[model samples]
Target: MKILNPAMRIIFLLSVLAFGIQACTNNAKEETSLKMLQNKVDSLNLFVQKMKPGLGELMTNIQLHHEKLWFAGTGLNWKLADFEIGEIKETVDQAKEIETDRPETKSLTMLSEPINAINHDIENQDINQFKKDYGILTQTCNTCHTANHFEFNVITIPSAPTVSDQDFKTLQVR
Candidate 1:
């Protein structure tokens, strides 16, 4: 008969625990990467909204994730319906249902859906109407916030940071 002694069993359990820990670590890393991409999206939107300019470099950075995020957002190579729209609706609906200190405005969610639509357009290389779409999304953010009593906390399109160190430019090999 095969048997695992206490010491062997403990070692085996520890190995499983180690693997669990590694998986959690990996998830955290991936989450951070996703947030970085979102932040860049926010930053670029701000720049565009304010007419601050400098999109070439920012776009180059956005392009770096062309495959990783911009495309994989759908979790598929090609699709008719915009996948990011589904994400926007899901997130906004969930956010609205949650009981927070303030009622849910879905300002950020509203604000980003149009932007994501633009991103979808960009990914398809259909550059004709992205800017108009983005403007509408930015307006949605402000309008939602004001209507929901979060006027004091109106979230604008994020711009070049005075505090954050995350770079949006595509990485360079040095």
Candidate 2:
């Protein structure tokens, strides 16, 4: 049997060690690049999901809530108005949550004060005050539309019933 000398054995061991280390280095580089690409794809998928509602559906929601608020407040149904204002605020908050990067999203934040005013009127059960504050709220909506280049989408003090299924009259005495 032939046996390697000490110096040759040392060289053989070092070569094998170096080959193993190079293989590990290549594997690490490939894994890191693959992970980076996967992370980007995941982030993009999340963003697309957030944008799924599109602008038309969002605008429709705001318009529907506005119409319901109008009917409730005008009918002197303060409780219904209160419920609707909460829905409106929550819908607006959802808009901000999902579309934080949009300029129109910032404009929606302008409704906070008007919403608060409407809330106060509802709490007081002051029909006249509610009507006045609701006008301001409509104005804010129009202002937001104008600022966002949606001036064509003018919102007004709703006078006619858009939702016929629900009674806006106060059914129960508070």
Candidate 3:
């Protein structure tokens, strides 16, 4: 093998050293970028954990909506009843999504039938059927609670409107 001249050897060594330095610099940059990305992901996870509502809070919202739904149906306000049912369904869906770890969430499926029944009654504008279906919905709620060992939290047909500011009756327009 032909021996490399001293100057050639120096140039070759310098080239290898330069390439090694560049590779190390790129590796360090990649590691820094990865750490920053991981930190961003951790921050988002923490924010979500803080913002997530508890199962009890979600159930309380459902209870309020349930009371409103009763008044709406009893007052023959089909539109309002429909809206209240929709809100209940939305809240139930949110509970299912956010409280996946809770066993009670699994029982939420039992509500779907009663909710759909009430919706059908509302669509038909059948006040009698709506009242009957509303009882069913309330009973279903109590059933779920009882099954979940929350029997003390009994749900019943509301005797009076909880909110005084809002009217359950449909507005009559001239």
Candidate 4:
């Protein structure tokens, strides 16, 4: 093989060095950007932990889930009804957590039976049974509200479809 001249050798070496330096710079920039993103995520998480959500917000979530549960169970969408029931139960648990200072409402004992009944009805794909249990659930909610001096916060079955965005039909068969 022919030998490269001194100038050509120097040029080749310099090119390799320059490429290496650029690669290192790019890696540093990427690492710095990753660190910055991680820092921002950590900051946001800290802020969220510092902020405790109020009872009203949690209760509103429960109400929305309740509505969805009603539509799902009424439409004979058993899976959706089950999902909504789980969400409602979770929201109620979250509300109880937020209201830890108040001991009396710690456990939604009144809701347990109705919730279980609804779950059983959904499992059996029994719409009529679900409706009957749902009525009992609504009455229980009203009773709880009255006991808590929130009698004005009455819940009732919807005459027509309330949530228009979603199709309350079974999406897929499991």
- After superposition, the stretches of candidate 1 with alpha carbons farther than 4 Å from their true spots are 1-93, 100-116, 125-128, 171-174
Going through the candidates in order, what is the number of backbone clashes in each? 0, 0, 0, 0
Question: lDDT of each structure?
Answer: 0.51, 0.85, 0.91, 0.83
Q: What TM-score would you give candidate 2 relative to the actual structure?
A: 0.77
TM-score of each: 0.35, 0.77, 0.91, 0.66
Clashes (candidate 2):
0
lDDT of 3 by residue, 52-159 (tens): 999999999999999999888877878888999999999999999889889889889999999999999999989888888888999998898888899999999999
Best by TM-score: 3
Cα lDDT, model 1, residue 4:
90
The ten-residue window of minimal lDDT in model 4 covers 98-107
Q: Residue by residue across 104-144, what tens digits does model 1's lDDT show?
A: 53343554667567667656745345445645654675586
Instruction: Encode model 4's per-residue lDDT on 118-143: one tens digit a residue.
Output: 99999999888888999999999899
> Which runs of model 3 end up more than 4 angstroms from their true locations?
1-4, 172-174
What candidate 4 gets wrong by more than 4 Å, as runs, is 1-50, 171-174
Q: Could you say which candidate leads in lDDT?
A: 3
Better of 2 and 4 by lDDT: 2
Better of 2 and 3 by lDDT: 3
On the 0 to 100 scale, the lDDT of residue 171 in model 4 is: 66
Please give the lDDT score for candidate 4: 0.83
Q: Report the candidate with higher TM-score, 2 versus 4.
A: 2
Relative to the true structure, candidate 3 reaches a TM of 0.91
Candidate 1: the clashing residue pairs are: none
